[model samples]
Target: MPMVPLLICDDSNMVRKQLLRALPSGWGVSVTMAANGMQALEAIRQGLGHVVLLDLTMPEMDGYQVLAAIRAQGLSAKVIVISGDVQAEAVRRVLELGALAFLKKPTDPQALHKVLLDQGLLDPSQQTVAVSRAVAEPVTSFQDAFRETINVAMGRAAALLARVLGVFVQLPLPNVSFLEVGELHMALADAQGNAQLTAVCQGYIGGGIAGEALLLFHGSEIADMAQLMQRNSADYSDMEMLLDLSTILIGACLSGIAEQIDVVFSQGHPQVLGMQAGIDELIRVNQTRWKKTLAVEISYSLEGHNIHFDLLLLFTEDSVERLSRKLAYLMS
Candidate 1:
């Protein structure tokens, strides 16, 4: 039998490059590409591939429409919807529409490969449990203690950001959960749409304890931020102001966490990007680098004011594992 063929349908060339890089090396399969749903359908009609990696937003036709079309034609190929638009309703709809699984953009290569294997589309023998039984009894005391510790560390980060901006900043206690990269994107998008600006930063924590952190901000409240920074109005453009604010917020947040945890850390400068771009562009940009997405969302409020913004921190698999280990140690 001929080796199976896979089709990758996405609008961005960058994302295509990343996906190609992330896929397992020896899957005995060939890959094809399509820029939109219409092209994907044509490729399928031609009997081109056995698997389709579909993107949700495209210029000509969206992923949902293509999925419906595929089902209508009774095409037997499996589809996996890969996107950064993480609304619960969207996930629910796609599942109902017959998409086999959903992977967020910047997907982890290992996770994606495992999903493929689990579906029997690939020959790998990896198995993932949806829910694992706890090996030890629940420790409520340590859980509460660590939660409080993280809260204080986050607060200190907020205060540092406020000092840098010369405004009062509020860092809300986050609702913690184990999140994949796609789910993190959804949460950030929901928050970003409601806020003015968002800033993102990535870095590791340590002193023998290490992990990653992300910071976000609201762009609309530039005036307040400028006031806090003690900078004159003529000093910055909208984008420049946002970048500067990110540098400060990220720096402070990381520094604060280090102090509270008694862990030492160093950071890289912020790489500022627009989060309000169209979903297609965002997916395209991220797909160039990451295979799996692991991120954290932190919300910030300006003290004595209604101004609020979101912070998103992204990490690679290595970083995530390191953080998980640290969290486990702290809880223990």
Candidate 2:
């Protein structure tokens, strides 16, 4: 059989260049590029490719709109959403719209290849398992190792945040759990119920970093966070204070993770949302298709400090691919 043709759609030439650079060599695949969704659709309509690598945030016609149009036309081509938007609702929405998979920005080459292979777009003969493990071995050992790593990383993050706020930080013991998409609502509900204050930030991390990261706070710690940011400034409103706190806390957390992961993340502006309302809306939006769950939860506390925040590292299915690649490398 002839190799599959791949279509990459992104507004950024830089991103397109990176994708070309990162794709595996000798894949017997033909790659084509488009500047935006309209171009992508036009290419598809011309039957130029059987698979599409799509970006969600394009001008004129975004990935979502393109996907809707493709479905309306009953296109058979497989689509993989390559985006930086990590919002649960957004991921869920795209996957529901018939996307074959979702790969977050800065995708790992090994993982992407595996996704292609799993979808039968790439020949299995060209694939290799990056990690060596006995088939009979229980998977729990791998989970244990990853759980420890995440605990250490989160612990360092909590410490860094505590220092920035000059308050005591308490972190819950780490737990390893797998979740289905449908169970996401329950998982997020439980996470939100215990949180006192929530603040979110969007940014990019790693080489060519271009993605969003959210830092959630508990309700009780909201006031403390406001106070910490206001300590040095006099004329800041509640909203301003919240934004400042998000900047500080998210910066600290991202810095700590970067140090551990050996990656650099560029910071972006912070956005504060109504805690309960935001979580509820997210749950409602994703409840339909994201019923299966797979996530790791960590809790931390800032004691003797005015604000307490819970840092959640929410990972979608695409994140799992990224995590698997990272873990394989670490194990190696």
Best by TM-score: 2
Stretches > 4 Å off in candidate 2: 1-140, 189-214, 229-234, 259-268, 275-277, 280-294, 305-307
Expressed as tens digits, the lDDT of each residue in 1-332 for candidate 1 is 35567888876554555566566766655677887899999988887658888877565888889989988999877998876444444566788999999886556788888888888887653222122221122233333333333444555556556556555554444433445556656755665465454545444545544334444555567666666666666757655776676766666656654564556776655544354343334445554333454544567776587577765555454544545444554444
Candidate 2, after superposition: displacement of residue 145 in Å? 3.1
Best by lDDT: 2
Candidate 2: global Cα-lDDT?
Answer: 0.62
Question: Where does model 1 exceed 4 Å of error?
Answer: 1-149, 185-215, 259-264, 275-295, 327-329
Which 10 residues in a row give candidate 2 its minimum summed lDDT?
Answer: 129-138
How far residue 268's Cα lies from its native spot in candidate 2, in Å, is 4.9
lDDT of 2 by residue, 1-332 (tens): 46557788876554565566556664666677887888999989888658898887666888889999999998767999886544455577899998999886555788888788788777666544232211121222445545545544554555555556655455454565667755666655665576454556454446432334456666665666667644555566666776666666557655654664566777756666553346666556544523543355555555565444555544444444455555564443
Scored by lDDT, model 1 comes in at 0.61
